[model samples]
Target chain A: MQPQRIAVVGAGAVGSYFGMRLAEAGHDVRFLMRRDYDAVKSGGLHLSSHLGDLSLEAATVERTPEALAAHGPVDWVLVGLKATAIPDIPKLVGPLLSEGTRVLAIMNGLSVDEEIAAELPAGTSLFGGLGFIGVIRGEPGQILHQEFGAINLGHHGDDPHELQRGVDLFAGSKVEIRPEASLLKARWEKLCWNIPFNGLCVIAGGVPVDQVIEDPPLYDAAHELIKEIVAAGNADLEAHGQSARIDGPRIAHLFLTQTLGMGAYRPSTVIDYNNGRPLELDAIFRQPVQRASQLGIGVPMMSMVASLVGKLGERVE
Target chain B: MQPQRIAVVGAGAVGSYFGMRLAEAGHDVRFLMRRDYDAVKSGGLHLSSHLGDLSLEAATVERTPEALAAHGPVDWVLVGLKATAIPDIPKLVGPLLSEGTRVLAIMNGLSVDEEIAAELPAGTSLFGGLGFIGVIRGEPGQILHQEFGAINLGHHGDDPHELQRGVDLFAGSKVEIRPEASLLKARWEKLCWNIPFNGLCVIAGGVPVDQVIEDPPLYDAAHELIKEIVAAGNADLEAHGQSARIDGPRIAHLFLTQTLGMGAYRPSTVIDYNNGRPLELDAIFRQPVQRASQLGIGVPMMSMVASLVGKLGERVE
Candidate 1:
């Protein structure tokens, strides 16, 4: 396949990492960023990982969506923007998308699909994405990917073939893209595992997961709470007839292990909190809570967690 | 009746206020304190309020429990020790309780009575106390009453007649003993009001009461949580078959008003949290939560607050 031109939106850790790798692999990649542009222009987007530090000297870094139009059209637009930044999506991405352009959203919440679907040009191909890389910003125009995995992508609708061109583009590089059997199921499965653990760690100021898991009462409460998220997500997926599937105990075990394994790394919510940056609390916590409420699932712990993190975000403002 | 000789334990705010008042009224008084004696012996004790400042040159201060014996026995002992120093209660009052030395506890929380009761000699009069004065250590051997109101003291258990001496001794002073049908109810009432507001304000690094109360959802939750406390307290009283006469709605109203009126006065918990001092978390919050659980009352919000505060305490430590 000819190397497709890609515009990576919100060039923070994850977006920058994938963009850098694609550019290094000789694909035409452009990073859409604001403050990071000067640094990227100077250093050409250096990425350090446990694997190795890689630099993308050929990648073009642009500041605005209008500037991306100046570079002409792109085949794919990958959005890794923070959910709080979603309201600005239509404004930011409008100039970059054509009718044939595929939009892939890799974020940490259940609302990413709806948010992107609302902002993108009508009839544009939509590929749902979830990135499992443990990435952090090392400096301006520099990021650290401590762990690497396939950037999972799925077609938003029942047509599995909808995302083959974009998937092939990523497969041509070092990144992997698995066609999800059911995108809704995949999204909810991610939510079932991600939201509770993230919320818990962030609100408790990132107490080591091992320590929290040791406490039987908190542990049990957490498991039940995660199950609530799972149930809610499953219900939502089932409503769409998207074949909901989540191994509850396995996900719980994974949460415990991941927490213990990465005890030192601050979660994304904690990072946002520490940086005085706007958090994706509404998208990540409140949106799911609203969904659970709509489905009439009693998610007491989820609601409590949402309220606390929401109040915390409000206090920061 | 002869002027009752009073022993003031922990010559801090509450102790010095009442102790100095009684001493000025021509009642014999001795203060049992650690560093208070040296300061008092050198310059006497300075008592200041909006009313006036008095240098009590005649008031004696003892540095230790043993020194209290050297100063001679007294008829009444007012224990004003910090709840953190509760373990020293027995030793502080040991020298003063020769025969009829009645004990009055003017501290935060409900465990003070049980803590001191276990240590007091059998047949000695025991009374519960609540001070409405907002006082603190102004300087060495100096106490300042920022806000002044009448005190409440009465017997906790049987023998309502046991508090007459307290009433008589506090005569002519601002201290007024409310003849409560049950002192335990009064203590619990104070605890119910203190836990949420105090902990929230303190843990937010001394954000004044107004900040927490001004927060819409938090303010409402705080008000409701206090009602839960009142309900829990009543349950406790009913379990003992004591009079559960505290008006929950009225108390909640008083607390909301108190928070608004406090303006910039940071609660002691906030001060302690800021200074890395040992917090009264377990005493004020955890104890009540435990009590609630024993009573089979659901206090999810209170328990969450307690857990968060407990975690904050651990972080600062």
Candidate 2:
């Protein structure tokens, strides 16, 4: 596999963790950041993780897209921003993409690929990447990885070469990357866990994942929400002549057991909400629920949580 | 109408406010208090209302049910405690009842009449009263009436005289009392507002009713919840051979407009959850959703809110 030049936009926890992994894999990884640019530039980037503590002593950091673009078009532009930062994507990443540059989004929620696809130059190959990791930004230029470090990557069309390219990008890294056949199905499958856990965490006043799992009623609520997401996902798949990949009971059990082992880890949504920052409500909640509604599928639980989280996001703003 | 003796068994806001009104109406109103005993005994009960300001100087206050029972079989026992205080009802208010005594529960939630009925002496006449008033106990003995002073009273059995007797007690008071033929139906009707406004207020992290109404998504969420409550209410009513009284859109409109005028009133459930007091979860949320589930009616919104609020209550404790 050939090493690629990668530019990471919105280098927060997700961005820094993955970019650091790519840099460790011997790729020339550049990070375009806003808040933590100075810290990352001076101190480099550090990841204290269960796998191993690693640091990039002198990482390439840029404060703006103009500075990142000055280095010429990169092979892979990894968009790792929160969904709330979607509006800033066109301005931030448009100039950093070349004709052959493929963009991979390590973010949450459904239709994220399409949303970013619309913002980028036409014919730019897009890959959807779902990060199932429990990592947090502890301090400036530092990350604390609690548990899980796996990414599911899938391309726009049925091209195994394109999918393998995304997988091969993390070849010698600590993070696991698995190529998926259907990006849409993978996103909806991810939503099976994200919709309930993240939304419930915020709606329940920023309660941690373990607290939600330990409480029987909240657990039952989470189970019901997971089932609703699965139902909506399967319905959407069937409508598109695709077989269902999400099993409600199976995924719910997996999430509960996994989250129980996660201790008191707070989800990113809860952290953003607690800090009075804008929630990724549109990408994580509203888009999927609205799409389900448009398909004439009922998602009462998701609808309720979406409206609530949306209002909560507005309140914080 | 003959003047009768009335004993208020829970001297919180609901207890004190109505107890003060009955005392002003020249009825022999006695309060069986716990936390506010000394405050009421020394300071008396003061009510500042839009209609008029009133106070009771040297009012009858009892520290125990035995003390209240010593007054000899009160004509009416008003069980005005929070539903969390229900388990103590058999011990606290059981001694205060006599053969001819009628119990009127001015409380929130459904099946409350049945809960109190099981605890009280058999063959005692029972009535359910839903308070639409916006009154809060500011201090120990002082109550602030915000707006809307109306109570819907309904008897257990179909008897006009029993309903009229319940109405006649508040004849000289400043509240509007309407008698309904069915207590069960009335409880469900109040839940159309309670399940949404009260439940959403807590679920949205203690957002005030005015804020909930002002925000579009929250209001939409509240509207959807109201519709679910109405659907569940009508289904329950139809199964019981009763017609529906809750009009979803109409009640939603009324609540929104009325709440717009309510300024920043916090619902009682929000208050209870905020103060770390035990929420009236079983009566207000769990029972209704369970009943709806048992009847094969879907109440996804209520189930989610109830579970979230229930967990929230547990966390606070």
Candidate 3:
């Protein structure tokens, strides 16, 4: 397989890990990060795991669009910021989007492809990628790879084969790309787990995973939330004349079991709250519940949880 | 009338305010304090207000039971600890509870009187009192007196004439006592306002009254919480063969309006949180909710708010 050129935008945890892994595999990769741009430029890139620590001395790191244009057009742009940060991307790097340049939003929540595609150039291919990683910024130049480091890739509209080419490019990287024929199923399944766990963990003040692992209220809430997301997703799929693929309830239970097995991994939202960063409450929770409302699906549990968390976020002074 | 001999326990804020006032009124008052005895002895007791700043140049303040008893046996003991601190009083100064002594527990929430009564000896009378004073230790010896300083006194389960005598003693001092014949109503009415505003302010990062005065959901939530407390209090009243006095819904509105008018006053829970002291969650919130369950009253809104706030308290590291 030919080595593909990749750009890892907002290279914090998930981006740094995946980018370094792909670069280590001898693919052409560059990290576009805000904080570690200086350190990463000096040190190339560093990725550390409990398994082993690998430093990519030859990988490129840059901060601005001018720097990226100097390296020329990339084949894949792994957009890794929170969904709320999606609107700011075009303003950040209008020069980075060349013809055939695929922007894969490797973030949480649902319908991110539509969000990204609406802003990109007309001929630009939009890809939706769901990352299943528990990576944290261990230090300025290192990402602590935690649990469930995998990715699911699918196209926005009717095409699945085109999305696979982007998925296959990430095949030999540290992250797994599980290419699904149904993008709707893939997106819904990720949202099913992300909304409850992230929103609850953040709102409940980063209570340990074991605290909610066996707890019936939390588990039940997660299951109920997923059901609501599934109902809403199905409504969207039906409106778009497409078939829903994921079994939301079953996926919820499986995720709960996985949570029990995962052994004390803090959810992304929890980490964000602990670090005093802006939470993705709007994207993962509010937007999903809003979409559910649009579909006339009652989501009392998620809505309540979202409301509490959203309000709590406002008070994070 | 001759000034009644008085003993004030837990000389912080309310206790110190009442103690100094009683001492100034020519009553032989002894303050039984744990921490600030040495400071008060060195600097003397200072109470600052717009009305006037008063000082007790030669006041009786003691840390130990033996030192407190040196001032002679008292007719009345005004206990003014935060509700959670009530359990510790029995062990701290058991010598203060003498025969035929009336113990006015000027603390917040329900069960404080019961907790004290359980520890009291036979022939000891107990009273319930609530103070709407915003007093804090300004320094080692000085107490800052903010606005709306008033006291409400009544008997929990005692003779009205005896309760009036207790009220008369406080009235002789600068502290104005709003004598409620039914103490149960006074206690419940305070709880109604407290459970909502205090818990909400503390949990929502100590939101001062001005923030939520105009907001509908917050104001509504406060109203709902107070109503539930009223329901629980009414049930408690019925179980104990007493008549409920205060109107919950009406008082909730009054409390909200008063808080809004005050503008700068933060609830006691917020002060505790800011001072890095343990919050009164178990006493102020959980205990009442447990009692509500025992009384077979449905307090759904208050329960959720309590759980949410309790969770917030649990996160305070």
Top lDDT: which candidate number?
2
Positional deviation of residue A187's Cα in model 1 after best superposition, in angstroms: 5.0
- In candidate 2, position A65 carries an lDDT of 90
**What DockQ would candidate 1 receive versus the native complex?**
0.18
What would the TM-scores of all predictions be?
0.75, 0.78, 0.81
Per residue, candidate 1 scores C-alpha lDDT tens digits across A256-297 of 566557645566776777777777887778888898889888
Q: Pick out the ten consecutive residues of candidate 2 chain A with the lowest summed lDDT.
A: A240-249
Q: How are the candidates ranked when ordered by lDDT, highest leading?
A: 2, 3, 1
lDDT of 1 by residue, B48-150 (tens): 7876677887567777777777877778888887788788776677767887778888788866777778888877788877776667787788887776456
Local distance difference test values of all predictions, in order: 0.74, 0.84, 0.75
Each model: TM-score of chain B? 0.93, 0.96, 0.93
Against the true structure, candidate 2 reaches a TM-score of: 0.78
Candidate 2 C-alpha error for residue A52, in Å? 4.5
Candidate 3 residue lDDT tens string, B161-205: 888787778665678889887787787788877787787676555
Candidate 3: DockQ?
Answer: 0.20
